[model samples]
Target: MYTISTKLKVILVLVGALCFSVTVALAQGPGFDEDVEDVPVPFDGGVTFITALAAGYGIKKIREHKEKTK
Candidate 1:
């Protein structure tokens, strides 16, 4: 049978706990009201910056892996 390492087990538990906590917090928060009008979310530069950073990091890792294999 396959076995999981302690580090992986701890990581999984922490992730599960975080997801559970977030779910509880969101459930307790204020919900939509029919009387109140919906507001549009403004475009944020931070999201674009993060997306670009992630894409660049992925490209860099892929290039590194290709070089290593060669």
Candidate 2:
């Protein structure tokens, strides 16, 4: 039983490590041969609004829970 649990733990650790692996590539800018204008990413406003709404909802829920407890 102990060996099985230890093997399960080791498998879980390996799986977790594999799941969270990240690959990133960084470059200074457009190459000297290429000319480009940097354009801002789209839909950021919607994302920001969604994030704020979620945060407000969380805060409201916390406040209600606190009031109920008191």
Candidate 3:
């Protein structure tokens, strides 16, 4: 189990809330046309690799933080 300090938890919650709100806004008020064509190909190998790297880094950071608290 991980124990997060009150301040750290509050900060994390605020940041997550901000991110969630921003994502919701972007999704709701889309500037891009849904019927638009000629869009670039979706998610080549490089994009997949980058996404995997980001997820791995986030998991590693969380694990390290938990270890430190222990």
Candidate 4:
């Protein structure tokens, strides 16, 4: 048997709500009844920026963890 902490229960509920909202919104789709033409999505620099930021954060956290273990 296992017991979940109050904090973890709250976090799980919030995540579940977020996922349900996203699913419902996606199912609703864009409101229009016309023939839509295929539009190409542009490659934005934001993707690269976010990737670099995440990589940097990950590296920093790994270094901190290694130091703490030492």
Candidate 5:
């Protein structure tokens, strides 16, 4: 079972990751979207990878924390 501090840390980490991703995305230069083509392919692989990376990092932290106390 996780202590309150552990839970809080996890939540804060997740929120920070979300904010970082949003800020980086907003800070990027404008892309070339000069076409109204039919069925536009939504390209969000970067976001997906970022999300996965964050999740993996979070899991690693949790596992390490658990191991450290044992």
Candidate 6:
């Protein structure tokens, strides 16, 4: 039988309660919606491709740095 200690149970319950509260707050919060104008900059296929490539390269560099530290 796996018995949970009082201290552990209390910590777990507190964490769960905190998470529930955060979720509820976010659910009721004002945020961007479908009606909002998400007007993207007018970019052709070449520009879009270049932007994606640059972003991917930046992400790859960050991941490599993180891996080296660990």
Specify the highest-TM-score model's number.
Answer: 1
Model 4 deviation from the true structure expressed as Cα RMSD, one decimal place: 4.6
What residue runs in model 4 are displaced by over 4 Å at the alpha carbon? Answer: 1-34
Instruction: Score each candidate by Cα lDDT.
Output: 0.91, 0.83, 0.88, 0.90, 0.93, 0.90
Displacement of residue 23 (Cα, Å) in model 2 is 7.5
- Candidate 3, residues 1-70: lDDT per residue as tens digits? 2456877898999999999999888887546777778768776799889999999999999999999999
lDDT for model 4, on a 0 to 1 scale? Answer: 0.90
Residue 36 error, candidate 4, Å: 1.4
The deviation in Å at residue 6 for candidate 3 is 22
Residue-wise lDDT of candidate 5 within 1-70, one digit each (tens)?
5698899999999999999999999998987688956687787899899999999999999999999999
Q: Candidate 2 on 25-65: residue-level lDDT in tens? A: 23245456546677787986889999999999999999999
TM-score versus the correct structure, for each prediction: 0.53, 0.45, 0.43, 0.51, 0.44, 0.39
Please report how far candidate 4 places residue 70 from its true position, in Å.
0.5
Q: Which whole-number lDDT from 0 to 100 does residue 48 have in model 3? A: 88
TM-score for candidate 4, please give it.
0.51
Ten-residue stretch with the least lDDT total in model 4: 1-10
Task: Give Cα distance to truth, residue 45, candidate 2, Å.
Answer: 2.8
Q: Write the per-residue lDDT of candidate 4 for residues 1-70, one digit (tens) a residue.
A: 1356877888999999999999998998678667877789977999989999999999999999999999
Model 1 misplaced stretches (Cα beyond 4 Å): 1-30
Q: Which one wins on lDDT? A: 5
Pairs of residues clashing in candidate 4: none
**Candidate 6 C-alpha lDDT tens digits along 12-36:** 9999999999998989857788788
Give candidate 2 regions above 4 Å deviation: 1-37
The residue ranges of model 6 lying beyond 4 angstroms of the native Cα positions read: 1-42
Question: Model 5 misses residue 30 by how many Å?
Answer: 1.2
